[model samples]
Target: MRSRLLRTARCLGRDYTKPSAQALRCSGARWQSTSGREWSTPLAKTLAEAISVTGPLPVAAYMRQCLTSDLGGYYTSHNEGRDVFGQKGDFITSPEISQVFGELVGLWVVAEWMAQGRKSEGVYLMEVGPGRGTLMDDMLRTIRNFPALASSLEAVYLVEASPSLREAQHKLLCGDKPIEEIDIGHQSYSKYADNLKVIWTEDVRFVARDPAKTPFIIAHEFFDALPIHIFQSVPPSQPSAPSEITTPTGKHTLNETARLPRASQTNSWRELLVSPTPPYSNHASLGTPKSQQSSGPPPEFELTVAKASTPHSLYLPETSQRYKALKNSDHAVIEISPESQAYAADFAVRIGGGTAPTPTPSLAATSSSTTTTTTQARPVSSSKPEPVHKPTPSGAALILDYGPPSTIPTNSLRGIKQHRMVSPLSEPGLVDLSADVDFMSLAETAINASEGVEVHGPVEQALFLNAMGIKERAAQLVKRALDRERGASLEKSEGERRKEDLTETVKRIETGWKRLVDRGPQGMGKLYQVMAIVPHVPPKEGEKRRRPVGFGGDIVV
Candidate 1:
């Protein structure tokens, strides 16, 4: 942690020695606009109108609108109605890349279940952001191999917000079974297991946390999509220009001017906000460096520092000591995601026994899980004594995403369009927007949220996958393909074609899995990370703590 703080301090010292003069100039005024029609997307116009009326939008507000707004957000049914995941989509996920990823994840869940004494009943499988249901499908198919774990499963719960994606998931997981609208969101039964019910909800809170049901939750590539607020530590005000110094003795006055005493105030945190870029703007106009500019017209929006302290800048940074340590550092930037913290806290409370906490002020408007809880209150009537039943902490939440292991994420927001990086501000709903996850923040939140839960890893995806036996799995898959090719030999010409097809299949399998564990500069293994939150039962005397598989522990079974 100390090292992380030092790294951040060095980053701040290198990048931001002085307040950005251009950013300060852009504050408190509307950018020069020629006409509303000049805006690229419909949502862009809407945002411009709102900004014109209210003021500049915080980066978080801008991101939420761009990514989840009902008016054609990136994830919603926009004009083109495009997919957000897969080879054709803006970005491809681990499951879409290789089945081994989800298979290993399923095994990890089973390993944890067995290690935790294997609850026979009241076991639930839940996945947040179940994109196309591919990961869940792969997981379920793999879990079915372990009959004991599979039979103990109660139902599958999917926490998804996009209706279009939900429909896609339904088609993939429940095929042909008409979805019935329920009080929460929607419900259907799985095609894989007829008896296993599947429920879809717009929010995770709708899926009530039952202390009785042990939940194994999966959150892959989820936290990075959540909105984040960026704050910059600006040094206290300085003089407008070189000024004549006034002294009581007039000796230090006139041509012999001495430097003025700097203000007594320390550096203050200010939020960076989103505002419309000037009409006909370019990278140079917005002070965007050539390296940061994307290949397109200038972005419709640009970031500017707020003139005064915003609610988020005041509260979010102060919540963590990691942020507090660098508060006085000049021009240090930090990105905080309250919604991410809220979700982490919720996952912790669900796995362990704890009272559900109200969402943080920054998250109240964003999250629906506020006030939802697994713990229930018992009515008392001053009569017979009420029997107390404390449910033992069980279950685990696995989170895999991309971010720094221990340091706060800084300047990590990005945009993707057609698998190419783009300016996040260029397209309102057309481009995918994401930011780096603060793994340390998540671990801190989960630990603080529930006494019964403990966090681990956030190790690199390479280390985790290697620990989970991805290499062995890939070898088995390749061998199976070769065996199948040999067994299905046909006529001379057909056999040659079949051999080519088999070769391609083998190559795809090998490359796909290798891509997952690739250690290149932009490889998934190096960029992504895996973390787990599991029930923590204090070891008695010299007893050892339980560590889940892929996070340093071996399979119990």
Candidate 2:
């Protein structure tokens, strides 16, 4: 039997950017080369070269290649030299649609900050997917009203994964600086920084800024853009089947295969996930199966999908919720991104209180400790936090995306080109490829990431926005409009005339607000969702649950 995987990276040749004929053959049928115009996309060529060298690529790998590839990745090439998120872009986010969205979010952060009594250590104001910085700008402007809260902010950070987006963010946030002078924060000025304080990076993994400072993270329409791995659940092997192979020399060899993908239900295509690693002898795969073995429960297997290059799957404990949670049908698919999970873990660690078991024991001990626990108790930042400390760095993260609370995404993967939906594989890096964020996994990751981390409602965007007071904000704007539109008409019916004059402006304001908060198809208020994680400090006497503002509202709207 041949080696299941030939481990052929070097066979690709000295130049990894260009695909070689020998490497193309190594990629098998999934990646084919052609000297035609169809293969003109720089991203496609590079991806082909990558696959040729690496063999079949995982869904996440393919997505990363297409989205962030330095050569011609869609986002890397600066949104493919096209506008990607406005009336003129591929799609528009809520922030770009209206200022109300940002204002409310800003207010929410303020409420949370004040509720915590303004940490002396302060907090890092951060936003994931800042987009042209419109959301953050609006948020900053709104927060500036509370000078103390604004002052409490140590710094602002933007978790951007695209070079093009980072450049755009600098231009949008830095105001009048020349492109040369404003290259992602070469110089740091505090005054100019109140507006341009945000630091940009192509990686979200390091955006926590400082582990010592609590992070007020706003992830609007962010997680959905992260890459996910697609997995197809394989049925249990037969009672007396030979899932393993034995060679003629009496040496047992395991079967190993690289990334594989298949078309599935509409808008979804299943990709290679964890497959059971067959018993192997030396370094070769034995095609012969040992069917004459004893009959017992078949060997169990778990997915090794976190990394793209994992050659075989292994048995996971029954406690593993991922593979266990897959639907009964063979068509059921589970998408997981190790990067997302890792991001969650890193965030959780920075967040201070992770769900790790030791914290619970520590908590039990703290409740019985001699020192007063004060308003809130937080875990120390270091691996070994000082024994008696109060106000552990509490961080709160709000994730907003067009994803449901559910983990299983049957067909959430697709492409959007100029607002028109297109096949994900159609143009490769030419289009933006995204899938719904698995908030369930994210929540779990948060819980498992660190001690003291708590998860909150993965509520509807409509409810979240409404709770944030979009309606009140809209009304105030309308009232302002009425004043601006009211002319010097003096008759008794002048009031009616003024009202009539203001109707269009009120309607305009209402329309944009509706688009942000409405539950219907045209509105993003429902399809999009909001979830948050913060330190769970037990409420004091008369205090109720301490959820973020987006989870509930005092106002009817």
Candidate 3:
């Protein structure tokens, strides 16, 4: 059944074995010769050459190369010192929009820590995709206010891949402090906290999981950036063959008769791959919308259905029941991100104990008693040691990103360049690519990966923030600004200028927070969502389970 489903699915529209001359021409037309064409970027040319040599590339492969390829990847490229964040870059993030966003996030972490018994030691703060380190810096500053919780923090871990972004984060989090090479990536002391060491690793897996410690993980707008494999369901074609037939005159003659598609045939999933558009293809040829067409140029790459079943098309969509349910629908399209699921699983395993091996062998083999410390340049760093036994699960992870609350993401791939939305296939490495996250898949993976974890609230960002008290926080900041203005003394004209400046300052603050919690059609609050994973508790017969603060329940401690 599996073989029949996958094999027939790949032959949709036409047979793969014996293609007619017209089919061959159509194939050639789709991916024209690159001889006379000039690509916009070096990476685009490289991608074209590679695709020419080796059939079309998977969307995941294209995204991975465009995003993190060593030479010209959007994030990894040091050429021209590309900046992918902030108003000057492709797009801005929540933390960059307002300080209140980060402050509330920090407060949520502290509140959770206190609710979960406030362990005196063995607590770590980790952030994945810590762009510019602005969120972490804001979070650390807020956490410092709670002496008990702040002192319990042993270390800070930042999972980042880009060298330029890492340096930017280092400069922001740890002013002029020297950063030294560590076994995993690099380590530096954060300027925001007292002797708090910050470690940067390219991947989260590099950090050894010690069930003894509690890790508060933050992934803000991270999952959306992960590469996604897109698949579409189409009616499968029946196998065809040239069968012999007898002529009407009773003479034996050869006839090309194909088998009819069976009524039992159902739609099957086919993976979409990325290939260079036909040479000099215009906006009309590419079928780009008039509203999306820019003065620049038509997209260089386009998504094409694979001619035959690829490994991903055969395997990925079948991995989940959610995808399986939609496989029979001819128009169903789904985007799956294995990287995002893996990261979510890792988060679950770290917070709620797991049996998975350490990412590195040497680290795995290191005895539980083994420990290491940073260089003696500054205050003593936290001791991170592998554990032999899985301790009681504790800690929490907060994921905030844009997507539907409980559905699989479809047709959500998009590109942003200088704030305007563009075709994702336009310019390789030059434009930023992102897709809506599959929150349901993430929750499923997290729960399946760890026995000690429970999931909560794939809720709207507005609901979460309102519950977290964004309005109250914004109000306090406004009051403080007004008080400062009232205490100022100057000449009449000077006072007038100061008053106007203060009024604008107050207005900006109000606007920023409102933008975050706004529920309008284009607002961030409605578009984005928040999810949390924490240690699970066995329910007693008569008592209700405790809920996290931002989700529904109040802080216990």
Estimate the TM-score of every prediction.
0.85, 0.70, 0.84
TM-score of 3: 0.84
**Local accuracy of candidate 2 as per-residue lDDT tens digits, 1-557:** 01212322232221123222221111112322343322436445544444544555555555555565444556655323466778787888888878888888888887777766677555778776688788887888888887777767777777665546766676766665643323332223233344335565333423433546778888887667666666655443223335456678775644332111222211222355322223231221111113312332222111233332142222221124765655345546666655555556556666764333222112221111111121023222425432212247476777888776865564566667788765565446667878888788778878776656678878998888877778889989987886776645567687777777778767878888899877888778788878888776777999876666778634211
Candidate 2 Cα errors over 4 Å, as ranges: 1-37, 78-81, 177-196, 205-211, 236-319, 327-329, 353-391, 487-507, 540-543, 553-557
Please list the C-alpha lDDT of all candidates, in the order they appear.
0.76, 0.57, 0.77
Q: Which model, 2 or 3, shows the larger lDDT? A: 3
lDDT tens readout by residue for model 3, 1-557: 34543443332211123212221111112332347676666567667766665567777767766776543567766655457788888899889988999999999999999988998899999998899999999999899999999889989999887768889999999999999998777999978675788999765656768878899999999889887889998777756544555677764544323344443256778888888888666653232334577666568888888766777788889989999999988868999987787778788889887643332212211111101122113232234433334467799999999999888998888888899878888677777889999999989988987888999978889999999999999999999998988888889999999989998988988998999988998678899999999989886999899888889979886
**CA shift of 251, model 1, Å:** 17
Query: How do the residues 1-557 of candidate 1 rate in per-residue lDDT, one tens digit apiece?
Result: 34533443232111122221221111123333335345566567667766765577777777776776555467754333467788778889999999999999998898999999988898999998888999998999999998888889989999886767888899998999888977666799888788888998656656666677788999999989888889999987755544455568664433322343433256889999888887676553232335556655677788899988887787888998999999999999999988888789878888886754523322533322211121112121224222212278889999999999989999888888889877788768778888999999999999987888999988889999999999999899989988988798489999999889988988888888889989798678988999999998888899788788888888897
How do all the candidates rank in terms of TM-score, highest first? Answer: 1, 3, 2
In model 3, which range of ten residues has the least summed lDDT? Answer: 366-375
